[model samples]
Target: MWSANAIKSRREALSLTLTDLAQRLDVTKSYLSYIESGKRAPTPEQAVLLGK
Candidate 1:
């Protein structure tokens, strides 16, 4: 499982805003925020996409 910190670090390292990454992942910014904040987890498919 990808940790919330890992996802957040990667996003920041890539200089992507929440909205930008949400669009790329085809998810809502609120959903992404939840994932980043450890309030939720990504689905398997979303994990694969995020891995890319």
Candidate 2:
């Protein structure tokens, strides 16, 4: 499983906003924000999508 920082780092490295990454992952921006902030974790399927 990826840590929250890892997700945020990857997203920022790609120059993507939370909204952009959320759209690509088929998730809500708030949810993605939560994941990045360590307030929540992505589900297994979300993790798979995030890795891509």
TM-score of 2: 0.91
Which residue runs does candidate 2 get wrong by more than 4 Å? none
Question: Candidate 2 on 1-52: residue-level lDDT in tens?
Answer: 8899999999999999999999988989999999999999899999999888
Q: How well does candidate 1 score on lDDT at residue 12?
A: 100
lDDT of 1: 0.96
Tens-digit lDDT track of model 1 for 1-52? 8999999999999999999999988999999999999999999989999999
Kindly state the number of residue pairs that clash in model 2: 0
All-Cα superposition RMSD per candidate = 0.5, 0.7
Q: Pick the candidate with the highest lDDT.
A: 1
Candidate 2 lowest-lDDT run of ten: 43-52
Deviation from truth (RMSD, Å), model 1? 0.5
Q: Estimated TM-score per prediction?
A: 0.96, 0.91
| Lowest summed lDDT window (length 10), candidate 1 | 40-49
